[model samples]
Target: MIVRPSLTRSIPFWILLVASLAVTVAGAAIVATTLPAMIAGLDDQTATGGLVYGGQSWITIGSGLLAAGLVGLFVLLALAAARSFLPVVKPTADAIEADDAETGDDTVLVRTDEVVPARDEVPAAR
Candidate 1:
């Protein structure tokens, strides 16, 4: 028995995985089945046949590495972008002392203490 997940989350990833696997499998099957014919047609060119298999193998290997590299690149890019938007925070005493800023210097305190405690209170015996 298979459990189904909601469309909002699991479906998209499953769909992509299934589709990619199907395409890769079907493509490899086609390439495998066609390789001999292709080689024979091209006068038994071993180099070409090897190149075809090698290319597919490289594509398989490169896919994971490419995905990882791109993910890492994007993470770095996102971090850099976020850093640009953030205010520089000073830490050391020297840096803190070097800071000079001016504002109205007025502070407002908001008092919020009108009582509404709980709904489950019972009167105590006096």
Candidate 2:
């Protein structure tokens, strides 16, 4: 029996990998965009509490997302490296025999100095 890699085992990991990357990037972008505004608005009394609080909230959420994504990515990569996330292919005796028979021995040896005629152009023995 020829063992093929199963997609069912790998599809979820692939989805998780993509999702983790997207979440990481989105978190980084949110933090990057929110920091400058919060810093710039710190002087105004009206912007101090509400603006700073909202920005801090976003920053916290973004940091959490970034951390979660990083942890997920690390775990997935480790699992992949350890071969836990990949499908294993096992070769059976029947498969080995079939492969061998399919590739029957047809090896030929020829010296560099000897000229070998093409099969279609070979002369018949007299």
Candidate 3:
């Protein structure tokens, strides 16, 4: 059976996603409000100053785009990494009791196996 995680159970994932979005929006807002003032400060008497300021603006914009892209890439990577570490919910004895009550069978068999051995232990010879 394929089990999908519920939103209530995945609170941390949702929190991280919301926090990332909030930070991105805050960063964009700061840049939008400050960039023009920064460009104006770069102006000087020489004609080359205007060219320099324009180039600076483009460079700032390019760097911001690159940073945003990198942040997105990293966030995606973090989510992928987090997927591998999601919490596993084990069925409690209460659940088994409910199952038994419905089926009129007291016996419920559960089998579990360890996939990995302890690192300190030596492997068995074939």
Candidate 4:
């Protein structure tokens, strides 16, 4: 029952976006820093066992956080698309009048109860 506008404008949308981005960035920073260190540790001649294990642990945590952030973003996208099928709201009377003034639509409809002559009876083009 939630409308598209209300859902997007709601607090949850911003919260999700901020939280997701924060998590993703944090994850990316951790992985970016650790991956290089881990690679160096593996190549070092006397690298301690702790360095490799610690780096691997951090990398795992960072990967998990990155996945979580991506999933959150996907959920946000789905929520935004969920109500897209709903038609847009009609313009208000004031808005309609404003548009009419700006666009200058001179066409008008006339209604009559009387019957008019057939096309055959009408005069030909001059």
Least accurate 10 contiguous residues by lDDT in model 2: 106-115
Query: How would the candidate models be sorted by lDDT, starting from the highest?
Result: 4, 2, 3, 1
For model 2, name the residue pairs that clash: none
Which wins on lDDT, candidate 1 or candidate 4? 4
Instruction: Score each candidate by Cα lDDT.
Output: 0.46, 0.68, 0.56, 0.71
lDDT of 3 at 19: 63
- Write one digit per residue (lDDT tens) for candidate 2, span 6-121: 44356888898999999999888889888878988875544667779999999999888888889889988786775533334445455556556667632211112222222335
Q: Compared with the true structure, what per-residue lDDT tens digits does model 1 show for residues 8-87?
A: 24465455555555555655555555555556656755457466676556555555544544555465456546544533
What TM-scores do the predictions have?
0.32, 0.60, 0.38, 0.63
CA RMSD, predictions in order = 17.8, 15.0, 9.7, 13.9
Per-prediction backbone clash count:
0, 0, 0, 0
* Candidate 4: tens digits of C-alpha lDDT, residues 1-126: 111244667798899999999999999989999999888877875567787888899999999999999899998888778655444443345544554676766232222233322223556799
Candidate 2 runs further than 4 Å off: 1-9, 43-46, 84-90, 93-126
TM-score between candidate 4 and the true structure: 0.63
- Give the per-residue Cα lDDT of candidate 4 at 115: 36
Model 1 whole-model lDDT (C-alpha atoms):
0.46
Best lDDT among the predictions, by candidate number: 4
- In terms of TM-score, which candidate is stronger, 1 or 4? 4
What is candidate 2's local distance difference test score? 0.68
